[model samples]
Target chain A: MDEKVLLTGNIAAAEGALYAGCRHYFGYPITPQSDVVEYFSAKLPQMGGEFVQSESECTSINMLYGAAACGIRAMTSTSSPGFSLMQEGISHIAAAELPCVIMHVQRGGPGSGSTQTAQMDYNQVVKGGGHGEYRLIVLAPDSVQEIFDFVQLGFYLAEKYRNPALVLTDAIIGQMKEDVELRTIDFGPTPEDRSWALKIHRSPKGKSANVHSAVGIVGIYNEWLARTNEKYENIKRDEVRFQSMFMEDAELAIVAYGSSGRAAKGACKLAREEGLKVGVLRPITLWPFPQPQIEELASRVKKILVVEDNLGQMVEDVRGAVEGRAEVHFMGVFSRHMPDCNGMIFPDTILEEVKKLL
Target chain B: MSGEDERKLICDTPDCINNTLLPTCPGCLHGVVARCVCEAIDDLGIQENAIGVVGVGCHAMTAGAVEVDTISTAHGRAPGVATGIKRAYYGEAIVFTFQGDGDLGAIGLGDVLNAVNRGEKLTTIFFNNAGYGNTGGQMGPTTIEGQVTTTSPYGRDPAQSGFPLHMAEMMASLRGCAYSARVGINNLKNYAGARKAVKAAFQKQMDNIGYGFVEFLCTCPPGWKKKPDEAFHWMEKAMMEEYQLGEFKNVDEIT
Candidate 1:
């Protein structure tokens, strides 16, 4: 265990990468996420590591691709527009089933959106960032400690499954500062473990290997893509992460993650004070959407409340898991206005529903 | 075919060295710059450790051309990507960029400038071949005054478009920059000079000196709507006006 330090989410993530022995970081200076680049740019060389402020998100991802191909742990971070620029490379990484980490402190949408926070890119993250059939091992970290935890987890799972991992947080969580507990954890990719990665260029016993991401002259490209998708499916099976509170004996559950999950926790506390049976499913890993957990909870719970900063992204997943088994509701505040986590919708506005249930 | 996708090749240029030696036809000057940079890196014995960041435009066409680890970036972003490579993988080996006028001068200009200003220990080979070769000979920031391309059908005018950008002169203004010189490939006289300047740039980095940039005033015949021989003459008559040949900055001079 190391001494605890007050750190920003960006610095916390950088520390986690450093702790995990990730020596390579490729990124461009995009707002909100710049701290991640700034921290490592100075610190990495001191530790004999690699820190690159790439020219664009596109180049950043490609650089990570190069490093990951060498079987080394590499990472990059960006916001909305920059992240979108990364979509193409993200898809390639997912398709190649390479091990790497990317952080997206999300901002508002479309083109050149404000360099501020927004959950508008929710659909982009969980639904497959670039193209083809794939999903990043997405983690929405709310606190500085969780940023550390999730970055560690992101690296662990990425190498564990030989896939890309994304730490998806909003500007609120990224820019905000808090105490980050510096606790060491099992966060390394063992050599025996990552046999599938191309670090050693283990081209199948010298069969004159042609390692390429190109779609084959034949249709192997699609099949190759399908292989990565299949890995995502398998990873989802083993990698689903979420925390369920009071769902076992409750009538309603809040499905949320990251900053939105923080607000949902407050809402749950108030709902409990009002004597309403409310629980929450806060996802630690997003791609493996904890579908089975939500499905199991829905079997007993009467309703599901999805709280998110976006309009209706994660709620759809909650509803899909419920499949009308439970009444699914939503709590959304655009990425602009922070969720009224101060119990804005509990015991007072939704008191009638809680009272009726109680 | 001088496009972003390695759509064209430049390997046929005289005395051009092909590192990949794969089967493809490249633009004549493409192989020249590639060989120059690779030789500089090899002369410093960084072949195994050096990483090349390629930008969009024709230079990006060389994505997988070299055997070394490479990162292909968006247009004009080679310098920034190179910055990332050297910063993260410091002391592993040399880090350099191969970029065209469009990528370096126009789109990725900020990255190139700040990378030099920050004086990051990376080498940049800015290919200042005036016209944007791939996109139907479009006007690039480095396109000379009165030069005609797809965008400027009636030839370039001072009022309609500002003066062509001078990357070497501009980058020379930064104190962080260790070395910068404008060189060329189409001519025998400047080609040797270009090779020397390129080697110096990489040597500056290998010696842990700061940032180094080499801008080559090369030729693009197909893009310039001229015969291949005429392209070299055009390189001589047009590009050398404002972008004079000389060392823009040398950190060693401070001593």
Candidate 2:
């Protein structure tokens, strides 16, 4: 059995990446996610891996692009503003069809909103934050163990489809400590064909391999777009992951993810104790969001409460998924235990909203 | 004799370049610089192990002609990208960035400087065509004082628009930089010097010395509103006067 070690969300992510064979880590330090860079700096070099403390998030993401182009496992981690700086690079990486992992430990934001935990980056991560039509495989992990597990999963999916994968968490999980099992997951064999990657030696194809963002010719671009769209569709069809708790005979459902999902679990228990038939639907894959399940749940449940740490972002997706089949409500930053940047949404507070809804 | 035999080859194209690919502009020296880079790679016998990171602008077209495995990066971010490739290869592969004035001097200045400061084992080939040729003659960081570009219709004024950035000198000033030189391909004498400078820059990386930089003073005919020949003459007289051509720094080892 793999040994279980107490670890913070950030350390788990770093260890997860190392175990997944990610040898190159390029990142800039930002609040709520700096521990990731610190851990990699101290440990990666010792493991004969590369760690670059980039000047900014922009540089870091571009570096990730270059490393990924070489068909190697590489990643970077950042918070809100830093992630915003990475949008352009992400778009380019997506366009080039290179595989890489990015960990966004979300914080409060419109600008530099707060260093504390928040789910404000839901729209940016799920929807295409970068320019052009592109999608990231976004994973939201609620606990340190899940963070550890999902990071390895993120790398697997990224390489499997040759697309960027995002591990989306928040400051609460990033800073909190929990037991995490440290082990290398068997994601099957690595992709056999890497002819597309930049070669250390000349390719057997007798032509130089090139990776560029722009497909300048129109017809080629259309074909590339068709291929990319189909890939995204395949990802959507096969990669939707979520956890349904007490959903068997519930009339009301709580839709949440990441830290908010953890809080909702507690809320569901309290609601059950008070004789309310409430359940929690926690989405693990935020991009190929469990839309089908949400639509199915909307058919069964009369009301769905979308809980998030921000001012209603993922609720839009939930509402769209329900498509007016059921009434959708929202509980956000205002429902936090305290009314400040460091405030958290407690289970009791979520239960109060659950009671008010029913 | 057959037509092929009748036509004696005066000069052979480097094996690392696809000679069928043409330059983006009539008077642009990007093709010349590309050929020189290919020749350096061939001379170093590292064509298979060379990776070029190209930045956005007219210079980006050079990547299409060069045969080395290349990654076209966002504007001005080639240095950062090359740094990653070099580190990932663990100094086993040759890594270099091909960038333009606006890319290396203005938008990506911080990335370039930081990479150099980090003593990254990489090479940078900067094309200074005075203005942004791909964007239709907009003023750039390397545009000479009093140069009239589309953005500076009334000629660049040092008071309003700052002085032209001397990148070779700036790189030389950095402790991490091992080699820095500025050269031009306007004339045969300068063209020879430019080729040598390019080769030396790549050699610096091959020896794992430190950051190496070579700035090429190129011409943009349409951007400067000059005929091809006139542009060459103008570059020799005007551009050379503003930006002196020669090696600014060379070190046996970086301390």
Interface Cα RMSD in Å, per prediction: 5.9, 1.5
Sliding window of 10 residues with minimal summed lDDT for model 1 chain A: A201-210
> Which CAPRI quality tier does the interface of model 2 achieve?
medium
Question: Residues A229-272, candidate 2, lDDT per residue (tens digit)?
Answer: 99999999999999999999999999999999999999999999
Candidate 2 Cα errors over 4 Å, as ranges: A203-205, A217-219, B1-8
lDDT of 1 by residue, B27-116 (tens): 437766776775565555555565667767766655345545555554565565455445444445577788888888887777677777
Measured on C-alpha atoms, candidate 2 has an lDDT of 0.91
Give chain B TM-scores in order: 0.86, 0.96
Q: Which portion of correct inter-chain contacts appears in model 2?
A: 0.74
List-wise, what DockQ does each model earn?
0.12, 0.73
Which lDDT tens digits does candidate 1 get at residues A136-255?
888888798989888888888888777789998877788788987787688554446433332222222232112234444213876776677677778878777777776766777778
* CAPRI tier of model 1: incorrect
